[model samples]
Target: MDSAVSDAAVGVPPLAEPDEAPQPWQTDRTRAPVATKIVVAGGFGVGKTTLVTAVSEITPLQTEALMTEASEGTDDLTDTPDKTTTTVAMDYGRITLDDDLVLYVFGTPGQQRFWFMWDDLVRGAIGAVVLADTRRLKDCFPALDYFESCGLPYIVAVNHFEGSEQFDPEDVREALSIPAHIPVMIMDARRRISAIETLLALVAHALEETPEE
Candidate 1:
């Protein structure tokens, strides 16, 4: 007996054909948005999370852990004494620019022990924004070196904290020995407009450095 006939004879219904109909959730568009990945890196307590939160269109994903006595000497809180939580993993957020470009931002964990995660986080990233604090300028060196050694395009974003002495971008460049070609900007991480500008700067720099395929 034919399988279809046998099944019908057995009172079994034939299997339904796969759905060719468009899903209600699906939308048709002439062009898809361009998506890019970006990394926000800096030293411990340098406002990486704040920057991400400020610019993220959706609620940002955070992996912060409360500071404990165990981290006493290892974690320095001198400049950010009020900080009680530290990002143990990475911070994630998304933003859309120009209606056709989407940016997926990832903020690296600032603790030295979490440096291992940096390699994984930077995968597929177009470029990076290395956040710096004048109070602990040396802390950002690791991030800067990591990006440079890996040959990734990066720009420095000095996160100006309130009450901290502000320095000119050129002065910061000179102080950090950053190459003249690398753009550096002073921004407040807590402000949405400032963070957005920093992201725009990074996107522009990355585009300039990337070769057309």
Candidate 2:
């Protein structure tokens, strides 16, 4: 028998193995999508979790604690009376857009006590979304002031709740004292499409503010 044939018949290993087909989940390094970090910030009960939940393709990581008597006065439940939980830490999720861009969304804890985490959360973030509830406009001031003081590019996304009075984007901008250049959008955090649009706007704004390489 020929040496090569004999070796093959004896189960000798080949010098090189053929490349296997790429798996469905495998992504090409050269063509890999650009991934960016985005912080979703807002006051308590403003639907930060809902927005992240709606936009994320995968199940989001939530750090919620059941509302107890301990927070009765500190955390107001006026508008959201039926609410029974609060984000004690943070909410995290991811979404991909245009098939070439990926966004890692991080939702900050709305309580003042957990605000110490904001510094770490926004460290490498490209921008932020400040969700606002019209009924309690003051609730969002802390988040707005935070991002503003940090000089991070951000947008005002009013999470319009049903039965609440609707305001035009411009009206919201004026009410929030947002700069004219900063985008203010009326979005429904519960709707995936609306949340996606708000994220798209933030991405566009961040790109515009970013210096060209």
Candidate 3:
């Protein structure tokens, strides 16, 4: 991830198009809005940390805690039995694009109870990137439902993990019951360019929903 960004900064080959600002409806500063918030969302262990840490301008504050065996029966530890640590509170960071443009990113905790906190986290958030792991595609349903119920625009980025079968975006959307308008993409969160592309898609999708004056 670091390599990708550093290379891009130095004018090395870039996989995506040259970085450009999102289409601006207005260019005035006094009437311009402040920074936007973007929530990085996904099922447990779907690479939220990796994506955030990769692109964040500052050191990320991760609230990860070592998981105890006592949580076995209580928490859903079905496929991820070896998972020892979990983020208890949240992960946060800021990304500054220019003097006036800043983006705040917040990563939600993994447990089901944390769902209650999402309402606050998503307030005024421009959009969310729903990370999906093909191995546990069903696990992302709760996040999807939450965003859909709130009418929060979002894009789903299918995370690629080792030994996971690659599925077409259409098939995955069919299985997840996602609307066609929502952007569905494939990405490796560990790569900076890949993660940035996901955010680009999210911002583009969100801007499209804004009623143009």
Which candidate tops lDDT?
1
The alpha-carbon lDDT assigned to residue 209 of candidate 1 equals 93
TM per candidate comes to: 0.86, 0.85, 0.82
Please list the residue runs of candidate 2 whose C-alpha ends up more than 4 Å from where it truly belongs after superposition: 1-31
Tens digits of per-residue lDDT for model 2, 46-88: 9999999877766789998999999978998989998999999
lDDT of 1 by residue, 55-99 (tens): 776678999899999999999899888999999999999876644
lDDT head-to-head 2 vs 3, winner: 2
| Per-model tally of clashing residue pairs | 0, 0, 0
Q: List the residue pairs that clash in candidate 2.
A: none
**lDDT tens digits by residue: candidate 3, 1-213:** 477677477443333233554324235546553587899887888888878887676678898888887677766766666677887767886665544566678888756867778888788899999999888898889999989888889999999887779999988999998899999999988876677777778889999987789
* The 10-residue segment with the lowest total lDDT in model 2: 13-22
lDDT of 1 at 96: 62
Model 2 lDDT, full chain set: 0.86
